[model samples]
Target: MEFETKYITADIKLSEFKGNTFKTEVMFEHHILVWFISGETKIIQADGTYIFNAGDIFLIPRNQLATVINYPKDGLPHKAVAMHLTKQRLKDFYSRHKPAGRLQPLQKVYSFPKRPLLQSCLASLIPYFDLGKNLPAEIASIKIEEAISILRSIDKDVDGLLANFDEPGKINLTEFMERHFMFNMTLDRFGYLTGRSLATFRRDFKKAFNSTPQKWLTEKRLELAHYQIAEKKQKPVEVYIEAGFENLSHFSYAFKNHFGYSPNTLIGRQR
Candidate 1:
């Protein structure tokens, strides 16, 4: 099934998916405020997994890698409204109101479920969605500002997330890769997140692992797939995508090549 999105503004949108389920991996460039109207969303990050049901609201910080799965609930399509809080916009908001104390960033998805204040704030915009072309850009901007304000008021520690704008610093490469290799991101994205240039990432990676990034990633992913199928008793179809392979065909071919047997063969032996 195809995903559909209707933009109330350039930054605010209503997204709908009418299907069994839709899953996608994404690295958000802007902080996202999502209000689930009628659906369930499962978000898997490097550190943890989160589930949000209908009437749930959450904040996803920018530059975080996550796999999101949206599922329809109660005979309705999975529907939600997402407001993107851009860097420039947040910078503008935080300039006038200073954030006290040193900024300490945390990788977390904040949830504010059943909060009357937040629910009211988000529900107020529902009417304007039907306005379509008639809705003014200033109105969307005003709503965004209101959201930022409400977020700070509701959670004082949110300033640490919204106010601070720092790029990814140099981190331990081996640790980063081992944690995030399941994500199918470009080498460039991996390099950027690890605070290295493409050339430097390549050089540093070779020294650390003694294998090229592509080769290492493939081997590591297949190992994970093998464990999941053989030990965890998961099917090849279920394990492939999470193992970092783009498609089942590729995953099956690679599984056979790497372990000298298809994943199904391993499953049959266990059975």
Candidate 2:
């Protein structure tokens, strides 16, 4: 049996997913504070990997790429509460209460495991999950504010991440694309993350790769998938999504078209 429940306001949510392991690649637009109630999560970023267990609290900074995999553990579903610290809310907060302390370099993810204060703040929302959309908006806002306050009190350098509101700067397109080719995102999103307009991204891409973005992305994804299937003996179903294809059928079609044979052919040969 499988089920999922979510009670979500604009800023806060309590979510539970049961049965199959779930995975996704995303770039968050707002900072996320998460409290795990059950199960486990593995988050892979460019910098490193992090695993969260039940009762663990963690903060994910915005504008960074990550692949998240959640699994059911000990017969409990992957369940957690997540709160969004939106840019506007943080601006207002910092304006009212000026942030002070030494600025630290940004880290990919912060783990605050078993903190009583944060646990209490997040646990208070459990009853509200049953309320669903009927949850009052002000209540959500207050809860987010409360979380921010608790973070500041517990971790002094958190202000460095929460108070700074800066958009992504221009980056080396080649390096960024090479590192993030496996994430399926829109061209506009890719362009924005690399600090370019769509037109400019296209132009720069053409100049650098002598190919269009779509063609280049497809070729790279397929190349990676080919390596996994042929050399690493991985199945198409296992590598499709991670290789950036949206679906198995699409991945199979593209693989056959590019390699002049089905992916299964390679798997069979390896076996």
- Residue-level lDDT of model 1, residues 83-167, one tens digit each, is 8999899999988889854378568999987888888888898887777663587888889999998888888888899988898
Error of 2 at 99 (Å): 2.9
Regions of candidate 1 where Cα sits further than 4 Å from its true position: 100-102
List model 2 lDDT by residue over 1-271, tens digit each: 4656576576787778887788888899999999999999988776677999999999999988887889999988999999889999999899999886647537669889779989999999988877656578787778889999999998888999999898988999999998888878888988999999999999999988899999999999999999998888888998887788878999999999998999988888776
For candidate 1, the per-residue lDDT at 215 reads 96
Q: How high is each candidate's TM-score?
A: 0.93, 0.85
The TM-score, computed over Cα atoms with residue i paired to residue i, of candidate 2 is 0.85
State, as a TM-score between 0 and 1, how close model 1 is to the true structure.
0.93
